[model samples]
Target: MFTSTTIGDLYQIILTNTLICALEDLTTRLNKYKLTACNSDNVENEFTALLENNIRSSCLPIGVENFDGDLAAFFVIENVEKMILKPWGAKNLSLESISLGQYKNEIAAITIKLEDQRRRLTPKLYY
Candidate 1:
């Protein structure tokens, strides 16, 4: 027997993979930092708190435009499954929420990049 693929399936796979990779990268970077210190509990606490704040502040904002774009792309892929299927109208609220999510991811990536750069610049300290 033969099998077929659907656009929705592909989009879901791509989105899931992207999210997994991002999370893995973030975890690896954090673990590397965590292992670098050889200090007292209090010092570790302080440093960890500071890094947490920096990561939170570096995240991006997801706007409606970003969400709508992603949704539109998704719809396009879905439409490929059946040419006669009409595009679903975009929801402003959903778009906004998705945009915010995208912004957060962007911010996370920035945080990771910053941490990586910092580690590279001070290899003796972090490594």
Candidate 2:
């Protein structure tokens, strides 16, 4: 259902789906822990691993276009954070020239809005 042709399109699709998946995982984890939405460190780690594995398997170079707007920003932020904390090598580096900090603020704002919508739309009951 969510397939794409070009790398750019595929990247965007992957990002959107990943974000949705991560958010769902986050909400489930949060509810299980009885928390009201926390930071994204855990989700970010999961997402980074997932993306790294998929990218390696796919054998595709990460492009600036791959990291388009909000989705791209999220990837960049998580990536940089991981790099800082864990100190990994090129495996985590996706885009060549783009600094992860390039769209930092915008991405943060958009992500918050997206998460807010997700929270509102999530069903109170999972039946």
Candidate 3:
């Protein structure tokens, strides 16, 4: 159902309505990254665009089903980690910026917890 509007696009919209409506503070981040405004002519901010695109692609491959606060934090952590590994100048993308109010270590711990939950085994039943 996903179409290519960018000529070279390869998947469903990287940032969908669910992402925009379901997730909070996304617009704020978009504004912060200056992606809220339409580009002029061929001028585009590839770096900031890639920041959101890559993080979404990396975190949720099939795309978001519904909004989960844990998933939201996970996505934020992924972004923060990306910025830390390959920073974009002196710019910062803090969780506080999105009002998550979690420290870096806390985000890591939450991520670990989420991963553990994903790997957790469910009790089997014979039917």
Candidate 4:
């Protein structure tokens, strides 16, 4: 039986789901840790590690043999640094609570670029 799905559709679906999973994992980690000044010393490294790990894991299900290893790493590090510098007063707020929206936007943009790349690779016949 023929299916309605095209390669572009498949690519988008896989990319979206993978990013969603990664975001969910990041959120869980943030909630668990409750980002605070106490952890500030290692937050950059820790956030970068968490984001990079999630992104790499997400790539596995999409059949990506090779990806720019530093793509997410660069963004995560930059954003986390910015977050740390922000004057968010009243210490009880979780880092995730303060930063999740920005992080979500970053992840969405990255996912879009991935989808665009995939589209370019299969141009003329799809997407």
Candidate 5:
């Protein structure tokens, strides 16, 4: 089951197993390396596209949306210790790598948030 969320006039996408996350908020969750070299104007759009494409190409669980962002990021972190940030200053792309620990932290926080969301949304019946 999927529930959609929209924030302001910005964008929203499924970020985890549970939550359709606000891109504005999720952008802050990304580490410096992920944001590096990304045009300041389009970081959220770029990352959202990257995550969606990665999720579609990967063979994750069926119930998990093919466009899930958290799973995609988690998968990438599992495969590599560092993510290359594209070059900031040069017209030529300059890429840099950094620890995936911050990414892991982002995933962990999302997991916690997912747990809370699930708990809050679960039905409670009293007779």
Candidate 6:
């Protein structure tokens, strides 16, 4: 039987799609702004900055906090997917089993705690 996707999976898909769209849009904007032919470092810097700004503007409305934005921006600048795809050891073991566990608890705890802090820290914005 084809069970429906869980909400978590759905949200992940949404976020991943959003990030992919942002990556594409940023590239287009960079081209328009004449950064397309620039050095790689400059291009990466601009993309990271643009990602940071977009997270502040677009993602804040959708409930993503400044920290999440910063983390996501870092991931984009780091080419996290590419890093993940690269072979890690002699046997070419998959990376997810190692890294996902570290992130799962840490990210969940931080997001939850920081969300509480965020609400308390700036009640006006939240309210």
Q: CA lDDT of each candidate?
A: 0.31, 0.35, 0.31, 0.38, 0.38, 0.31
> Residue-wise lDDT of candidate 6 within 3-35, one digit each (tens)?
221112223423433433444443343233311
RMSD for each of the candidates? 19.9, 13.3, 14.6, 14.2, 11.8, 15.0
Model 6 per-residue lDDT at 70: 25
Off by over 4 Å in 1: 1-98, 123-127
> What is the alpha-carbon lDDT for the whole of candidate 5?
0.38
Task: Tell how far residue 24 is off in model 5, in angstroms.
Answer: 24
Write out the backbone clash pairs for model 2: none
TM-score each candidate: 0.23, 0.27, 0.22, 0.28, 0.32, 0.24
Report the number of clashing residue pairs per model: 3, 0, 0, 0, 1, 0
lDDT of 1 by residue, 1-127 (tens): 0022111222332333344454455445433332222233233343334434454221111122222222111111111211111112422211111332343355467557755765566637454
Q: Model 4, range 48-121, lDDT digits (tens) per residue?
A: 46454455422111232222222221113333522332111322212322244555455456557766776677
Off by over 4 Å in 5: 1-63, 68-81, 84-98
From the highest TM-score down, the ranking of the candidates is: 5, 4, 2, 6, 1, 3
Candidates 1 and 2 compared by TM-score, better number: 2
TM-score for predicted model 2 compared with the true structure: 0.27
Instruction: Give candidate 3 misplaced runs (Cα > 4 Å).
Output: 1-44, 48-62, 66-108, 118-121
* Candidate 3 lDDT by residue in tens digits, 84-125: 112223243222233223333343454455445544643456
Residue 108 deviation, candidate 3, in Å?
Answer: 5.9
Find the 10 residues in a row with the least total lDDT in model 2.
81-90
Error of 2 at 25 (Å): 14
